[model samples]
Target: MPFEVREFPEFSWSFSRHKTLLTCARKYGYEYYASHNGWLYEADETAKHAYRLKKLTNVPLAFGQIVHELAEKAVRLFLKHGYVMTEAELIEEGRSMLNRAYLDSRDRKQLWMQKPARYKMLYDMYYKGELNRLEAEDYRGRLHVVFANLLNSRSFQDITTRPLSMQFQQAEEFRFMTVDGVKIFVVMDLLYRDLDAGKWVIVDWKTGKEAENDRSQLALYAYYIMQKYKARVEEIEIRNEYVLSGVNRTYQLMEEDIGLMLEKMKQSIHIMLRYQLDMISNEPVEMDEFPRTEYRQRCETCNHKEICLAQ
Candidate 1:
């Protein structure tokens, strides 16, 4: 058989992608366009470097990911085997995962450079060459708090104590829906049928403090849920489970809320399309067409700063 020729993935819209575009157009280009096919052995050095930088993670992001993973693990255990991981077990596993990442970034530079997709290269270590000991300890403490809060979270209790039959959708699953002919991606942390409330509950696990965009993000998820599940505004319940603080904030979304979210998405897509060379082909223009942000401070923490700043 002949070797298969690979093509770049089609462009797609997502909440995170929209945010990235807003944050820095150049970064958006590198992440979604320039890095395309960077995995190919014959790819350019610039594309390869950008792709490696794109995979860089920091302490906060890594912490949130680990917590989400553990949360998914807990849901799977209870759903599949009628078991929930103990708090001690959750903390132990979280710490171990974090430690491995830390060690990888600290000691496995050659390995990470060789296989950035498989190995973790933390942003802090990559740029600063070392992490502050005090900060590392603080994140470890935060990890413990997140797991403890997760166990005590209302969403977790509802998931574990409620009937397994009430579960409506899989946790942490990649799902998408189309609006105005544009594909929108959504990954619900936890979604279930609330028999008592006669509604579908969408839980978003938060490992860090709340941000202004949290409600809007959930609103977008609600839009997808409504479209895909044929759920009405009243039939859907939105929740932000801030595991770090053990706060479960529920938002009562109206049809108007989802409508606004759709409009925002449309506007965002329109802006992004301006930077593309061919909307049909999802092709991006020259690198210089996507300008870097005027704000210099943001670049300090940007993953693509190495290649970006070199310009």
Candidate 2:
């Protein structure tokens, strides 16, 4: 076969991407630009390093990811296999996953360093040399609360108990919709039609404390559902299921909210476009064009700190 060149990374927008750009321009460059083709053997060292660091996850994020995975698994099992995972089962499964990840991060340092994409690398382990024992146990202990809350959550109960035939979208499925010729990426935790209420519901499983931007993120998901599913704003209900805290907050989207979100997205895209040397190719300008954040605290926790601080 003839050699085929790799395609350049496509420019896309997501809530996380927008937040990253707002957080620090330099970190955004490392994540979206510098790490583009770092998997190739001939790639420069900086690109390779940035790519590896980008894959690093801390304790909180890893914990949240595990919860999300289990939540998806539970939903699929009930909907497809007619089996519901009990609280005990969920806790056991979560513990097993956590143990395996901890071992991978602790014992497989060499493998992770060589191919970070294929293995887990805890930020605490990489930078601090070890995870604090108390912190690890704390997360482990919270597994019970998390799983219990998940089982008792209003959304979870509603989803599993309702007819499996209800129109629903699976969790963790990467999906996108175009707005004004720009691709907007969205991944919903769960979405289903509430047959009783005659409403389409969008559920976001939150494993962390509620943040100010949580509603905005859900609004974006609501927009995706509205556009692709052709549901009206009046007929849709958005929910933030805070599993850790056992709180479920619901919001009704307005046409005006979506309008504002679109405007915000457009402005963010315009700002990002300014840094591109070639818009068609998504090629970024000089590294310096993306300035480092003045906040030292952000740098302290940044994934690209190794290379970013060096510069």
Candidate 3:
């Protein structure tokens, strides 16, 4: 007897278009789907610590809390002094915040490991240089535009707008399926309304040099959003903020482009279905000629990198 292959509808909705595709299709099949790669949310250790401490009986969130506090302070100081905050000052504030948290009687060494000095040093590097560099050079002149979308009172906004009100550390998960009946779950960094256009915008934040060939990810995401909500999607935006370099770039989705991508997604899914059918029928796998993908420095940080190897 054979087990049944799982399949589900693709009409689900989500702020995260990326996850929806991933959840719905085979990972390799959806490799070209819109991608959200970056360090803004992934780099901050403080938020990770803070989230962990939620059930730790007051063990205080570590790096992210301190970093946010320090960053808020740094932003304030930047506003007042009209100068860049030095790396050392940010580190000092972060250290002080960490110390205050660690020394709290309720937080001492009970549920958490003492943060290593190296971690603090790494975070300082991320803040003082990496994040700053990207923001200054690549992402210059878009702060207000980005902030407006992030700070909206609405539940969903684009990455550019939402980061202003909430730190990149926060994310929302959305689930939907493709037309071919595959369930997907995307943990979106941000979603927003394009007020001027009266349309919903979906976003994914990126941290490095934007990939010219990665529009597929965005396109698939946009198609899913349109399919799920039955709303006119004005645009799909991807905010690539180079945390290490501090550079930012925004990509907007066009109508024709999305249409082409939707077609591509359907083709890919059918190809994947064939692969699944072949596996079930005990057919020999016709592997790709050059099977191995080159390693990317970013791969070290990818959640799916380990699984990629097995594939």
Every candidate's CA RMSD: 2.1, 2.2, 13.2
What is the Cα-based TM-score of model 1? 0.95
Compared with the true structure, what per-residue lDDT tens digits does model 1 show for residues 159-272? 777764375575545588877788889978888888788888888999878999999999988887778888898898899999988888998999888888888889999998
lDDT of each: 0.86, 0.87, 0.40
- In angstroms, the error of model 1 at 247 is 1.2
lDDT of 2 by residue, 1-311 (tens): 79554545788999888989999999999999888778777877877888999999987888999999999999888888879899999999999988877888999988887788888888888888899789889999999999999989988889677765367766545699888777889988888898778788888899989999898888898888788888899888999999989999999989999888888889999999988888888878888889988887999989889888887
Model 3 per-residue lDDT tens digits across residues 139-241: 2233323333223313222332333443232223345464545545444434454555455555444333456645556566666667766755454454434
- TM-score-based ranking, best first? 1, 2, 3
Give candidate 2's TM-score: 0.94
In model 1, how large is the Cα lDDT of residue 271? 93
lDDT of 1 at 280: 80
Where model 3 places Cα greater than 4 Å from the true spot, the runs are 1-174, 184-187, 194-197, 235-238, 277-311
Better of 2 and 3 by TM-score: 2
